[model samples]
Target chain A: MATFIGMPAFPEASARAVGDAQLRHNLRKATHTIRARRAAVVAEQPDWAGLRAAGAAIKDRTLRHLDVYLERLESAVTAAGGHVHWAEDAAEADRIVVDLVRATGETEVVKVKSMATQEIDLNAALAAAGIRAYETDLAELIVQLGDDLPSHILVPAIHRNRAEIREIFSGRMASWGRPAPEGLTDDPRALAEAARLHLRERFLRAKVGISGANFAVAETGTLVVLESEGNGRMCVTLPETLISVVGIEKIVPTWRDLEVFLQLLPRSSTGERMNPYTSMWTGATEGQEFHLVLVDNGRTSVLADRVGRQALRCIRCSACLNVCPVYERAGGHAYGSVYPGPIGAILTPQLRGLTGPLEESLPYASTLCGACYDVCPVAINIPEVLLDLRAKVVAGDHRAERLAMGAARRVLDHPKWLALAQRSVGRLRRWTPRHLPGPLSAWSDTREVPVPPRESFRDWWARRAGEEGGR
Target chain B: MSSRDRILARVRAALADVPRTETPEDVEVPRAYDRSRSGPDVVELLIDRLVDYRAVVREVTDVVAAVADALARRGAHRVAAPAGVPAAWLGGVQAVRDDPALSAADLDALDGVVTGCAVAVAETGTIVLDCAEDQGRRALTLIPDYHLCVVRRDRIVRTVPEALTRLDPSRPQTWISGPSATSDIELDRVEGVHGPRTLEVLITPAL
Candidate 1:
């Protein structure tokens, strides 16, 4: 019901989710299906481990020399007859995209599913600019028509069931492009048919198409997009003007580097050894013009950090999200950003900074279980990043947590001070309420803390030692 | 200043601030090793890998009979041939006429999806599906779960790098390793999650 659970902290958001039986059932089923298939296909290759290592190494090398590769990519694209644009942030990316659409004088466009656009909230911004962006991917169209935010990266509407989708299509599809047939049933095949018919018309009519690339080949100035649906291909080729917004991290050094990724991406993204529709476009074609926008919203900042930079290597494969226990339980909406799983857990905080309660709480969302890291095609050391971010949150940027950790550090720094603190706990234990007062109660709101022991463990240890000595 | 100018300036500044760390890093081309002797067997190796991925291999001595028999076995409801598919190769398939511009639903209804591949790699059991020269658009092999991909043995490469060399510098390319699948927590396997579940390869002998 909420656009995003952006306002609430984890406990609050999780409390709401745990109470929703339907949402839990949907997430449990979807996540389990994808997670199991990914492991099986991944294990089929004895070289999968080697492939993971190579993928991680390639991403590291590229990001480490991101400037050089991006420069090479830009020139290669321009030479191939494509135009390249640079955008600093979401607003700039949105503006550049809007201008590109406007220059063509197109009022509407068919869009391939692009996380970069969603990150910048391009659809909302475009709507405000009087340009309608039509989402061609079925799940994306569902979310767009229902005016919903994407919950998962790969399957954006992973949170919604077929019945909910049917309702959305039956009620909302008309105003968008083509309305659903009357008396649309809850069957998935029916909903898909409705979406296919609706999008096919737009594909034929639209003059411009919008997309985001999964990888950009520097050697050939090629942009790679992988999708299960054929909608992306229709949008990319049928339109006369193709404007693609790709993150700067998408660049790979050469066709050789691209080869590794083409192998790594499919396995990681949709649990496919090879994706159904893999769309790649270079400069302008026979009658089409191509514009590539390299977006660095907060990526450059992310790239500057040695420990946190690994997130830039992500191929946008939602495998990490599907396998994440936290994401499966809390759902993507709880992450408060377009990216709502393990990758989002690390990337979102860094991109937006640990500013609000939402961002700061993200780093602590995981139990450091390392499931995401194991599944990451690039092997981003997620646990290490989480601990590093937690340290930052508890030290400086997150002042409230900083103050608490500072007090704990001081009490533990001196023995007498610690004993005094432990003694006070023994006295306070008797009067300890079932819950803490006011805002502090957030900790005990959903979970209960065991009552403080009558005597500290250290005190008990000393007493046992003394009794033994007397005996 | 226009928004573009402001954005350019900011991007420039951001570039300036980021430390230049590209201190002569190697491209790790993989073929960077032998460097020279990578060309001859590339196509044969690509075919080897495609077959390794469980792609059904059938040599088309006669393009007409081969294409017809492949489609007939599947009892295809429809057949989407690449816009660039050779006239002779698609000359056969009687159940459904060779149509390049079928609807997505119509494409899905078909039992067979056929397209010519750009490159195939031997080491990784993967094939390159690019929109450069032969493959029309990227969707011909995507919508339907059964993909009957054609690979000229000359288009095959021994290593990933050699295959990369075969890809046209101008068109969009799709690299496919194998059929799509996923594994859940209890480790249950599911097929056809996204891509084609059945991959059939038509290995046309080198002319």
Candidate 2:
């Protein structure tokens, strides 16, 4: 599987991101715009809190009886003329997809914007096996053409402006399929037209389509995809064979449950009461073959965690990303995973396990300000999970920090020792240096070291008490 | 064990701490959302919402004139309609009747598609097509650059829940809010993507 191998730890990548003036500008502009819009639409729903609670409850019920639901879903899909496959991990899922595409004797497949495919690096896997996957979503197309990693969940090319998109479309479209028309301007509509013409041919001719579902209804065996561009509609409908890789946690118990998500997702993600399009198909359509791959790629492990399991309720709305101050400054690439922002901080470590420096740094990537919790449509308590992961991290490694914390705990445990230490520090205030050496310097790297006061509060209190006694 | 059995086993083990006897019905889901309100209020709200998405909405007594005017305004010369659509609905505009065997390229060659919708949501201004006889296939509304859908005001529901109850889950459904749009470019909504560039919905009086 293609992984975020050899990626730098969060701090290093974030430091570089903070220095990129253009990236910071783009992140601020895009995030702020979506944030305000989300707030407005959310305020319109008088029972938003009730809806969120219900959404969370529905997911919890599905997950608690996941095994039973999976069986029911498999049978439901089978009855609907769709084949269901189970994948233990990314490798298995990729193998299933490649084999399915190979069976059709097709070398190229068009894809909708799917986080699952990105997680498994399915396109790269297909490429290794001599198959090409074309991303048809407008933002995804920009990312694929630019040979860049997706920086945002909803809008992958959020970091790029209109001018950059035009350049990418102009320079890259020819190599893929249709070339951009000459004199293509940076206007968004013009760029969209160029893409529509370019991908329309691919959509019309492609034999296979690959996608990820926003919600998969177990009762009806229906897969639902919510998108703006008709690209998703084209990919799913116009193809001869369709393969969907869905996370196990995406299942909702009944078709009626779509009411909660259909309400929460658009408002929280795109700030629209309803997105431009939502396509729901039970299984195989009349002319198309269908395959459903239920992927457990680290999701089963995510489910095993008690406190951490709530992360499974995430609908991938990216509301947390829009409200994250850390994400705004550090940018998405700094997270080193397809999943980024507040959700990524807790989710990545749990899914991939905290074995690497990148995963380890992810837990500490948040200020725990709880803004992510406020905007989450599912109401996933991101800060609670972040702190839980942090405790796990602290329990495992960071011997130096642990030792330092232990020493501070000793002083804090004894009031007399703390007062004595404070008095000595007060006496040395005049001679204290502004900068420190060693690991403590990491703290002062971007901040000034505070100066110690001339007198201890304890001494001042004692002196005042003696004066009162004398009087 | 097979991957399927292994995954199920894993899921079972993961939830070992929770009682296995608990059923999905035991969980309480609050449906406090407003699913009430109907009549003229719902139809007006649908129009207001559709206008917000830049969809050209019109209230008309004569569907034929409305459809004809929509095609004329867009200078659409070649239009398509499903065979089941009432001929009187497309009285003035000449429409190429859709057949099941119509290739995607054939549909793409047309200027626009006009049809009736299965249902319309008043709160969200969404028109859902269930591939019914009049609505034709999913590609009919998608491949064309222009889409003119005639929605009966009686089909307009107050909320998403109300609309869901009116439709069936077994059939393939396409929910359209406006013309194809994308917020991909700096989160700024640019309408007209791969779907129809222009969406004109003619609202007929409640039956």
Candidate 3:
């Protein structure tokens, strides 16, 4: 249940990630494979671009009028025999879930892998309250057992290779519930079998199931979870009491709107035309008690910013992460949030605010490559948002940077000042070192310092024009 | 103000720059994605997609023998089927009729479950169960190690929207494309994680 507070800045963390050969190898292999598959399936659709446009439009429409749709969803969920609770922040959301679980007098709960729950650190919250929440998704189970944070959105343990997973399962399975079979191997199927045996007992006996929604239909009051494993089915169906904590932005206007997202999300994230299973339930079932927690948790502030609110439209597809070059090199850990990569580059800053060094550095974690925007099912224009956040960072704090930029702006805005500065640099070109020292060493460490080009382009142009005129 | 009202106020305040008169419909969504391209060939596409997902698909003239044979092949002797399903469907197999009173352990002990689906989507090879009479409770299909689903050919739809129209929004729905699977470990797809490890689909003929 920890937050990404006090994390080291992006440069420091990414420096280490860039050095880890194994991490880089795993990331490159996984992202490139998924990226190629996504490109192939997305190409199969004749109207993928249209669908992407519509997905963005629908999300924009919903976000602008979220108050109305959320109200509609709450009423609809209530009419369907469910309770709706509103939380302004993470602590309140966690409290509401803990109390709901406590009311059922249940000490254990099964969880579907949910980014919202992860964002709020719900499992850790539950653990502190003397309740153990078992993660049933194979990736999440690996993350939980290994006592690690989820690095990827869809495959949380994307950083772990099969051999490492075998070790994790073999070493950690018994303490949880069932033990891994003798001599468990690194084969994917065998590992999956070991997890299945371990989590089956917990899923069957658990009275409470906790989850997050991919989309919450305001019209039908249905929450949809698209997943690859049957863990979602087991948790959502078998539990007597189900509690789902979803972000306020997850609401869509109607069931028909799902057609647009269903087409866009699967092809973008898992690179499948459709995932293995999609579970949709309108509020509670006949026998199960249902509770829907709508969490604001800085969402209201996010919605307030007209330019930055587009991050809210994300379906948690992780396509942006797969296509991002920086994400490939730096891996998911550098962004220092539950969300990492291109979306996180813009999102974590806005959600947490650029108040800390780590949060501020996140905005610069991108090269503004626009690859994320190209593949985004919702067309978030991540580069647009990144540049916008960078402007905010520049406008705020950083006295040295502000002064330096001001001096540069003065020279660039005036022709004479710029010429004088360029000539001075040209005259000193012979004295210039190939590398710089002190704080500027970071810039010149891996790059050759330019020799001021002998003369500024402006002087060369003027001289050539004069010579031509004389001739 | 309470968190609800405060949150709503914040939302309104956040959108201060947005004109107050704008409605959700003001943002026009281009619905030009090909929803009309589906046809009868979608059925074959459905079978191909299901096969790609590695589900055992049997186009059988005799439903009973096909289901029984598939169950036998999976070594599932004590199978479970919804009471509403025709008794003849599992004619020669040892069938445990679905009971709401059965616990998870009770259902887990069974070798597999056989049930009819409400509808199947051709485009995605998805079989949707809406907790219908024949479909039984969700646990019937989920808890067991193997699931032998009977999808009638006529009940197959060309697209997801068509399947959504056939379903009752009130009933809980599980849209299963294949057996339970995961791409969690280094993005390699592995079947049989949580739900039925093996999904055997019996497509009854159009007649």
Best by DockQ: 2
What lDDT would each prediction earn against the true structure?
Answer: 0.74, 0.91, 0.88
What does candidate 3's lDDT look like per residue over A1-471, in tens digits?
Answer: 435667799998898989999999999999999999999999988788888888999999999899899999999999999999999999999999999999999999999999999888898789999999999989999988988878888888999999999999989888888899999999998999898889877888889999899999999899999998889988888889999999999999998888888888888999998899999999778588999999998888888887899999999899999989999999888889899999988888888888899998998888887999989999898999988888898789766567778899999999999999999999998999977866556557656997787889999999999999999
lDDT of candidate model 3 versus the reference: 0.88
Error of 3 at A117 (Å): 0.8
Sort the predicted structures by TM-score, highest score first: 2, 3, 1
DockQ for all candidate structures vs. native: 0.23, 0.83, 0.81
lDDT of each residue in B13-95, candidate 3, tens digit only: 98887788898889788877776564558668888989999999978889988887887788889988887888998788888
Model 1 sits at an interface RMSD, in angstroms, of 5.7
Q: Between candidates 1 and 2, which one is better according to lDDT?
A: 2
TM-score of each predicted structure versus truth: 0.83, 0.97, 0.97
Q: Is candidate 1 or candidate 3 better by DockQ?
A: 3
Q: Candidate 2: count the clashes.
A: 0
By summed lDDT, which 10 consecutive residues of candidate 2 chain A come out lowest? Answer: A438-447
lDDT of 2 by residue, A157-233 (tens): 99899999999999999999899999999988889889988988888888999999999998999999999999999
Q: lDDT by residue for model 1 over A393-452, one digit each (tens)?
A: 777565545566679999999999998899898878978788876655656665686688
Q: What share of the true interface contacts does candidate 1 keep?
A: 0.20
Looking at model 3, give its docking quality level.
high
- Candidate that scores best on lDDT: 2
Give residue B95's lDDT in candidate 2 (0 to 100). Answer: 87
TM-score: the better of candidates 1 and 2: 2
Candidate 3: residue B204 Cα off by (Å): 1.5
